[model samples]
Each structure stands twice: as C-alpha cells, then as structure tokens.
Target: MQSIKLRIGINHCLTDNNDLRYNGETLSDGFVQHTLWKYANWIPVCLEIETDHIHQTLGCQSEHINDLSKKYLDGFILTSNSPRHDSFRPKVGLSKGGTSASNDMGVFARSLSLKYPALPIEENDRLHDPLIRENFLERIFTSKRWNIAFSNSFTPHALIQFHSSHKFLFMSHSVSLYQEMGRLVARSGLLTLTELKDRYVVLMSSSLKQMATPNKHTNVMQHIMGFLKGLIDADEKKEIVETIDQYRTGQVPWIVPITLLNLHLRKNSAADWVLNQTYLNPYPAELMLRNIV
Candidate 1:
C-alpha cells in the first residue's frame, strides 16, 4: 500500500521565544496555526516570519535557503493581513529598499522559488475559499453569516456572495453559537403537545431512540434545558421552553442556514473528510447532507 504523504506549511511570526499567545502576531494567526498543528501532522515548509528586520536577523542566504527548502519545501503559508502587506507595494515600488516588511515576504518567496523550483507553495487563505468559509460557520452556528473578506490569495465567487448577503463581516464564536441555536428553532418543524413531550422525553433519555433522533428534529432547546435543569436541580426544561418562547426577541440572520451547515460538516477538516469518503463520493456537499433530513 502506498503511504499518503502530506505537505504542511507553517505561516506564523517566528519570535526569538516560541510563545503561542500574547505576542505581536494577530489572534487569528495563533488560532489558525494552533488548530492546524493540533489536527494534522504538517512538516514545516516555509515559515513566513512577519518581521521588518529579516535580512539582518535571519541571515537570508542562498545556501541556507537551499537547505531549508530541500528539507521541507512543499507549500508556503502567508500570515500578515493582505491589505497591510499588499498596500505597501503601491506606496513603495516593488523594490527591496522601500519597506522592510514587503521586502521580507518578497525575499522569502524569491528565495524559495530559486531553491525549490518544483515544490507547490500554498497559503492559509487559499485553503479558506468562500465555500469552505460558509460551510465552516454552517455547522457551528444555527443562524449567522461570515461576510468578512480574508486577506489571502485564494478568492472564489461564492465567498463574495456570502459577504454581500450578510449584515456583519466579523463575529466571535460565542455570538455565532447562540445564533445557531436560534436557527435550530426556526428551521425545526412545529410539534403538537404529545409530539413535543415525546421529543422531550427522547432528548432526556439515554436510549438508542434518543440517539437515533436526527439532529434536525432533536429538540436541542429541550435537551439544553434538561441538561441545565440537572445542574441546578430546578425545572431546567422550563428554561429551555422559556428561551424558545422568547426566540423572537433575539436577532437572527437568514444566512445562518449556510453557517450552521458548514459547522456541522466541519469544513476545516475538508481534506481529511474527503480522504475518508474516497470509496463513497468525492462531493463534499453531498457527503455532508447525507445525514441531514
């Protein structure tokens, strides 16, 4: 059997001390790097160090470049915000002397190309196409849309559609999670008195019937309430009921359908998910919706 080989690249600010948090790098950089390293076995390809003093500190030479590329050149991950980095080109022509930051990335790209001509270079932004972004939010949030434009080389038409349709561009996970719960309510079918009680009982029970309940009609609201009731020894089920009753009070977006779908499907694991379903089908959307009714 042929072993599956993967080329993983790290795009981060390599400081003298390898602190994962509370450094000069953006929070998103830390989050993205942490998630990737935690889930996948990626060999360090090209470390796009975000720094002004790259030439003097890192000692960028042809021999050193060849050594690193020969050892781990599969792809390159660009970290800095796209606008900040791209804007520098206009202010200071595409020369090495104008801006230290722009020059650093240019130098790194050129050196990698010179040393390893055949290796494929990829960035984090390239992996997060618009479809991937929508899919990611879909599973996690019941009702929210991610509209923010990513600062990477990869851009698809679907991503533009998401940005145009949504009200906000950026949102935190906590907010997104609540919005997702709201979506579960809106999208769920109306249940009669007996049906609602039966659904509630199934959600509360640990039997196979409960587990078999499809996520679409699982009555997450009641489940959440039951869980909470157990914690405080109160009528937790009432809390869930009350929350659902007050659902109209909260602001929910129409695009959350996309976000919720993406979240449940786990879009970040697209590559792994694709490999797992090689015998079944290659279409991600089809595989994702297989269980959804």
Candidate 2:
C-alpha cells in the first residue's frame, strides 16, 4: 500500500512547551540536530514574533518582518491576537522606510510569490488576481476583516471546520494573532479542505491543540464533548464512541483527527445521523449548521 501523502500545517507559539511536542518531538530534545528527522513528514512553518518593542516603541521594521516571513512561511493568514483580543491592524513599517499595512502585506505576498511561485497567497480580504489591491469597497461593506481579527480564533473546532472541504492545511508558528485568524478563517469557510482525497496535503506549522495541550489531560476533552454534543447523533454518536474506545485501546493510534471529524459532520452520512438523533436540542444544531452553510 502506498503511504498517505497528506501535508498538515500547524501554527503555534515556539515558546509554548506543549506546542513543541506536536512536531513529533520537543525542541529541547535535539530540535536543532534532528530537525528534519523530528518533523520528517511535516512542514514546520514559524510565525513572526509581535512584541511591544517591535509593534509599539520602536515600530516594526519591514526588512525584519520580511526576513522572518521569508525564513518561516510560504503563505500567511493575517489575524488578531488570541486569548486577548488584540487588533490585527498593525502600524506596518518602522520609523525609517517602513510600509503601510496594505503595502506590507503586498510586499510579503510579492516576496513569497517571487521566491516560491508554487505557494498561493490567501488573506481575509478579497483581492484582485495578483492580490495587491486591498479592495476598500469589500473592506467597507463586509465584516470579513472583523471576523478575521477577532471572532473564533484558532481552535481545533475551527480547524475541523476549515478542513471540512480543503485537502491541505497551512499553519504558522506565532500563536497570538495568526492562529486566531486561522481559526476564524477555518470556521468562516474561507479556507476549506478539498474533497479531492488524492491531492497532496501540506501543513505549514505543527498541530497546536495536540501539541500545546496534552491529549489525554487537557480541556480538549471538554471542548470535544461540547462539539460532539452540539453535532453528533445517536447512531453516529455510537460510532464515535466506539472509535474513541478504539483510540483508547491503541487499536487506532489517532482516533479520527479533528479535521476528519469536522468533515464527517458536514457530510450527508453524519448529517443524516444528526437528524435522526432526537434527544439533542435541534435549535443549537440548526444554528450551527446555518452558520456553516
């Protein structure tokens, strides 16, 4: 049998100890020496660090930002800080030859495109073919920008939503804002997992939830329960429970990854199961489906 060629990107904070484990190993455990071997099948993308000195006091340097972008990411998801609702809108360049927000994004996109033509650039706002123009009209009329920065920041729930349709997922390293935006994008359906199962899958960063939070001992159980309660039905619930049991038994090492779970939820098979399960309050399920649709 051929090995599955799926590229899964995880965006995370390098500083977070939990995030280090998702890369199949820890940073302290020979991250530098065994970098490729540790992340053998995954593409580790780092996120640009946003600090008080860089964003506030000294102002951001375009070269510094560009250099970071070049070194870490092939693509980026512009967003706001998580845990704290920091604004996604940055001042752009430094006191010297700094760029504006739009200009900076354009420069980054252009630079990435020029360097790696294979990677496609995607942001919250709609842009022209080359993705240079900010499309002020859409920005003014729609709330994609607002959703990008604040609501539904990066969570496994959000990634499940995103990979519901797209085959490949890309994540950055920085945790504050980009991951939050990635969550929103995944939820909003801007980034979807393609149904083409044969396509190559690529993930930029490592899995944040699995890495940052311990699998067996974390709040993820609560969150997963909430998500399952909100969606799963009697028959599907039985199946999911069985699957979870198998996961616990080590029969299935990775119980359906959250990405697949969300995709299953969106599919007709799970949808039918959901409709059949009568005990669940239909209102919340209805609302959730409506939001996704």
Give the alpha carbon lDDT tens digit for every residue of 155-274 in model 1: 334333332222111111122433443343343356443453333222212111111112222243233233232234234334334444443233222122333323323433333332
* Superposed Cα deviation of residue 39, candidate 2 (Å): 14
| lDDT: worst 10-residue window of model 1 | 139-148
TM-score (C-alpha) between model 2 and the true structure = 0.23
lDDT of each: 0.33, 0.32
> TM-scores across all candidates?
0.31, 0.23
Error of model 2, residue 231, in angstroms: 4.3
Query: What's the TM for model 1?
Result: 0.31
Q: In model 1, how large is the Cα lDDT of residue 81?
A: 40
Candidate 2 — which residues are off by over 4 angstroms?
1-222, 228-231, 255-260, 268-293
Model 2 lowest lDDT segment of ten: 133-142
Output the lDDT of residue 40, model 1.
29
Off by over 4 Å in 1: 1-5, 12-23, 26-31, 45-52, 61-64, 81-105, 131-293
